[model samples]
Target chain A: MNSTKGEKIFYGINYFVLLLIGLTCVLPLVHVLAMSFSDKHAIASGAVSLWPVNFDSSGYSALFDETPIFKAFRNSLIITVVGTALNVLFTVLAAYPLSKRYFIGRRFYSLAVVFTMLFTAGLIPNYLLLKSLGLLNSYGALWLPGLVSVWNLMILRSFFEGLPEELEEAARIDGSSEWRLLSQIILPLSGPVIAAISLFYGVTHWNAFMNVLIYINDTNRQNLTVLVQQLIQNQSFMQEMANTQPEMAAKLTPEGVKAAGVIVMTLPMLVLYPFLQKYFVKGAMIGAVKG
Target chain B: MSKALPPPASAITNPSQEQARTRSNWLVRKYGKRVLKQNVPLYLMFLPIMIFFLVFKYYPMTGLVIAFKKYSFLKGIWGSPSAGLHSFQMIFNNDQMIKIIWNTFKLSGLSILIGFPLPIILALLLNEVRKMIFKRFIQTFVYLPHFLNWVIVGGIVVTVFSQNETGVINHVVKWLTGSTFPFLYNETSWTSIFIASGVWKEAGWSAIIYLAALTTIDQSLYEAASIDGANKWQQTIRITIPAIMPTVIIMLILKIGHLMELGFDQVFVLQNDAVSNVAEVISTFMYKIGIQQANFSLATAMGLFESIVGLVLVLTANSIARRFGQGLW
Candidate 1:
């Protein structure tokens, strides 16, 4: 436990360097937050760095009142909630049968699922398929194609397989149906794994972008992630924002509006981050166990 | 306690046994009607999942055949006339093809080269820390960016690197050098920005796996090494790296396997007209041609090419890793 002088110096440099790297990861986000609350004149004069200069709430007021960001936020919530529900449901259904030792066609079914992970139809064909199926511009386009992620399915299935067979066997002896067995005996026992996979699904749905961009052409259906990107990068969208509220645009700078939009999109994740931090580390570590 | 335990999942899932069971379906039927009755709910639960895979996954896989067809919306996937090798020919013959392919490789190669080792190094440094609170605090900030989607990360990149007055890095650069660099517009700067942002977003999240691996190394070994006069550096070189080498190789192989996927979101969001030559990866190129321009066949061909290369790389990587007893499969 005793550290030599040389080791002490080494540890000192290591800690300092790590702290710098960690700060690099976080400071940009802090800068963005600072810009969101700073005055337009202060932001314009490049006075904002990591703290608000001439603090104002106008940018957020402008973001909520002058833009469709609220609608986009609602859309994100709907997609994430509904999408995660379906994902967890399908993942459990798929994993349960695959986990059963004597389930007919289980091996065949498992391989069939795993094969999709090894190869996929890629973006173009998947897009074409969605279009042909009348799913384009619908939330189904986002939800249906990724009904169950193979990676999450594997994680849950492995967890299910590891459960003691005695519980299921005893349930069956009581004339309990497979559905009841899963709902009562199996699911309650698998809360940690379910929570982990649910977090995985929830995070992916909340951050849904590429599918939304490719599938949903309607601006109203777009989620917060895409909306924030448009606010930040789309020049014409900025024009539309200004045109929508000339007085507000004049008052709030585009950079301030963009920063506000970014914060709005990121706030939920930040709020839930402590819980996500705890669960996801466990989830990823579970992945290290060979499935 | 008297109840006989069923076979474990690994035992039942052996490929040979599965094949044998398929060959003897009579055995499946011997327990059939009663078994089927008992398992009806299981089958019912599984039916929708099968339908999802069939309609979404396999059906789109079948749709990849459009790569060879002169696909027309009116004619439909089946009704379209066969174009033989025409679509692939266009992909190969076009001058932009080589550049696009090279750009994809150069970007992904640089990403793996710079991005792969970082997390391992970070994990080692974190492990060296005696204070648990400091290590956890550093991890919290480090892993934070990975949760943000690529769009948010891209926005951050643009914000920090923009040549305008608001851009943080450029403002500093201008103060020092008296001129601003167009980080997102110029090809060279764009590539650097792209790779740097990628590392920033992912390195900490990636380090979690290595940290997990590090935890499995027995503490006794470290204690023994220290007792033998092996300094911290010597212990890490001899014992620590050796224990985690398998995980490292497996992760490396997986990274190489995904060389073709340059992440469509990152490239699409950050790229502009000025940097298109260097940033135009296959996924973005396919999206523009297939979705925007409706050049479905050509784009499908390009996708097929990417997937096939991805498959080959994974298999090659797995086999190589097998030599070291660390294959994923």
Candidate 2:
């Protein structure tokens, strides 16, 4: 428990390096936040850095105005909520049965699931299958293919396996049905793992961009990430829009608008994160140890 | 409990032993049927998940045959004529194929080289911290970037490294050296930026495992080492590093297994016309030719190639790890 002066210096250097690394991770996002609220002239002149030179809310208001960004945000919310729901439901259902020692064909089913983690039919064939299934251009394309993540399933299964067997046996002896056992006994005791897996699924669903880009041809149905990509690619046009639209010219700058878009898209996860941060860490550790 | 118990031993030796044997045989058959029947509810619950995996996960695997076929919209996957190796031949014959493959490997290799050890180092340094509040704060801050999707991270990368006057890093470089570097445009700077951003995003998240492993190392070993007049550096090199070596090796193998996939999301978001040559990895290339250009067969062939290589690498890595006593399986 005691350290010499040399060890004290080593610990000092360690804290210093870690603090620097941590700042590198956070400072850019902080800069983005400052830019999102900076005045148009301040943004244009590159005066904003870690803080707003001249404070304004125009960029955020511009986002709220009749923009495709808002619609995309709504679509993203819908998909994340529904997709995460299905993900947890399917993973739990499949994991619970497979966790049982006496479940018939458990080995076969477990292998079938684990095989997916090792190989996948690449994007082309997956796209083709979805096209044939009439899921293309639909939200189903976004949600259906990823309904059950094999990694999350394995984590949940490991958690389920760690549960005491005597509870289930006792429930069965009391004439409780399988549904009752799962709903009343197993699930009640599984709050932390469930929360952890749900956070993983929620984050995956929220960040979906490739599926939206590839399968959904309809811009109306596209999510915030796709919209953000379009905004980034069309930076010139966005700047031009600021010049042409008098109201926007008064209120917004292109850089500030882009920063606002980034903030809006990122804010949900950041907001939800602190409350469930421990669960996220727990989920990652579970995946590392078990997966 | 007594009611559920079997009869006493004297009853089993009587003339009813014959009847008891037949009855027990019947009971065995009945028990087997009941066990099978008892599984019905569980099977029903699992039915929907099984159907989902079959349709989405397993069925698309069968569609990999489209790589070997002259796939057409009207003919469908099954009805399409077998092109055999024609599509693969086209892929191999193309000059861009080599460039794409090389790009995938070079980028991924560089990332793994630089990015792989960072988390271990971070975890080691973080382990030295005595203040819980400070450690937790640093952990939270560093882990924040991993939660942001590549789209946002890519945007931050572009913003920070923008060639314009406003770019934060460019401004600093100009201030220091009197000239700005085109970090995202030039091939060299682009690669560096790409790898750096990857490290920034994932290193902390990856460190969680190492930190967890560190906690499992017995505390008494360090105390013993200190008692023997060993310093912190000596203890780390002698005890801490060796303790986490298996985890480090397993993680390295897993990283190597995905060498073909230079993260499509990260590459696609960061890619532009200027850096296309160095940035166009296999996944992005496949997306362009297969999804954007609608060259289904060729794209499928390219995808199959990537998948096969990935499979081989994973199996090879797993075997190697097993030989080293650190295999994932």
Best by DockQ: 2
lDDT of 2 by residue, B1-329 (tens): 55788788767776777878878678557557667767888899999999999999999999899999998888888999999999988878888888888899999999999999999999998998999999999999989999999999988887778787677778788889988888889999899999999999999999999998898999999889988989888999999999999889888888998888778999999999999999999899889989999888989888889989988999999999899888988
- Per-candidate interface DockQ score: 0.63, 0.66
lDDT (tens digit, per residue) of candidate 1 on B1-329: 99999989876667986778775686656667667666677898899999999988998998888999999989988899999999988988988987898899999999999999999999999988889999999999999999999888877777777778788888888899988888889989899989999999999999999999999999999899988999888999999999999999988988998899889999988999998899999989998988889999999999999999998898899999898788887
Chain A TM-score for model 1, please? 0.94
lDDT, candidate 1, A3-105, per-residue tens? 8899999999999999999999999999989989999898876778999999987889977876688899999999999999999999999999888876778
User: Which portions of model 1 show Cα errors greater than 4 Å?
Assistant: A240-245, B1-25, B28-40
- The candidate 2 chain A region of ten consecutive residues with least summed lDDT is A235-244
User: Clash pairs of candidate 1?
Assistant: none
For model 2, what is the C-alpha lDDT against the true structure? 0.88
lDDT of 1 at B224: 94
Q: What lDDT score goes with residue A149 in model 1? A: 96
Looking at model 2, the pairs that clash are: none
